[model samples]
Target: MGLWATPTLAVLPSEQLKDPALEARARAVSAGLRCVVCQNQSIDDSDAPLAHDLRVLVRERIVAGDTDAQATQYLVDRYGHYVLLKPPFETATWLLWLGPALVLAGGAGGIVLWLRRRPTAVPALAADEEAEVARLLGDNR
Candidate 1:
């Protein structure tokens, strides 16, 4: 762990809010936001313009007297649930959360089908049908 040891928030000098408490709360909120630019990195750890904008937006919401939850919800309302690092389990995200499980179950069923042996010899032709064939062929040519 070196320069990357600490999460690199793109908080510019001019953008650092004066109130430490408010800034701390903003950072906490940012930690749960997914950076649209980085995709995988949290906004708290991204320097992308969108990440910076989101951070500022969170702070602005806090200063406007919105509670933390409200501020977060505001972002969600704007960006869709994809902006949240941990999206809630709901109809919209059921496929995202359960897609892999469904695929695995389907593959297992396929494998079981492939591994099973086929029916050996077409129902054995029935006992009477076998006797008829024998008589048609004669006792022994």
Candidate 2:
């Protein structure tokens, strides 16, 4: 009844099973996989053929005795890390993880530089205005 559960199995007939445990594992793994075609969606929620293929591939690898990490690693290797819902923090991913902070720092530095270069406001008084102000304020002796 929730947004995540529509009871729709997009797998092939041969992929359906009565084993709840395998199905559960499949769901668990699939839910953490990103759909290459639909970047924002997990394979479980995607109806794309590539998503279905990835789902089947995951089930196949799991049934073949690959651990969850192994299966995920296989997908990551095959898809070049783009298939991972959560990319690992490594040298290759450092920029992706730190991009926002870097951008913010750069923006702050630019603002500071701009402020430093900005001209100071100087009040230019006309001859008459200057005399009036001097008279009202009592000119310094």
Candidate 3:
């Protein structure tokens, strides 16, 4: 099998944490960041150049004594809410989160209205036709 090629992280080697806890924190931070080149993938899973750079940035932040929330806020501040998979509940995002349920409710209401307006099936034929059938059967008894 051919050797797997790892993408080069852009930060200097001195920026990397020597301690295991900091390394874990760095990994956690990296996993939250979306790869700009691959919008659907987080930095941890993407091999794109931007993702490599983001991985390095995450490590750098951790080494610089930034907490996970602080590092995430730093990225979010730069990139805007589009980078987040789960955006916060705010006026701008309320429609994005609740639009589907509202649409479903509207559809259900339309169906109910249509059912109420539809005509009922009416029974056809006259009294003479009913008598003929009774004669054919000898009598109603």
Model 3, 1-141: lDDT tens digits are 222354444333554578979877887777677777889877867767777777778878877888998888888998987766567789999998899999999999999999989887767768998788778888554
Reference-based lDDT, residue 74, model 1: 95
Off by over 4 Å in 3: 1-25, 112-141
Residue lDDT tens for model 2, 47-99:
89999889899888888888888988898887887787888889999999999
The better-scoring model by lDDT among 1 and 3 is 1
Clashing pairs in 3: none
Off by over 4 Å in 2: 1-14, 95-141
Candidates, ranked, lDDT: 1, 2, 3
* Model 2, residue 14: C-alpha shift (Å): 5.2
In order, candidate lDDTs are 0.86, 0.84, 0.77
What C-alpha RMSD separates each model from the true structure?
A: 7.1, 5.7, 5.5
TM-score for each model: 0.59, 0.59, 0.58
Top candidate, metric lDDT: 1
Among all windows of 10 consecutive residues in model 1, the one with the lowest summed lDDT is 1-10
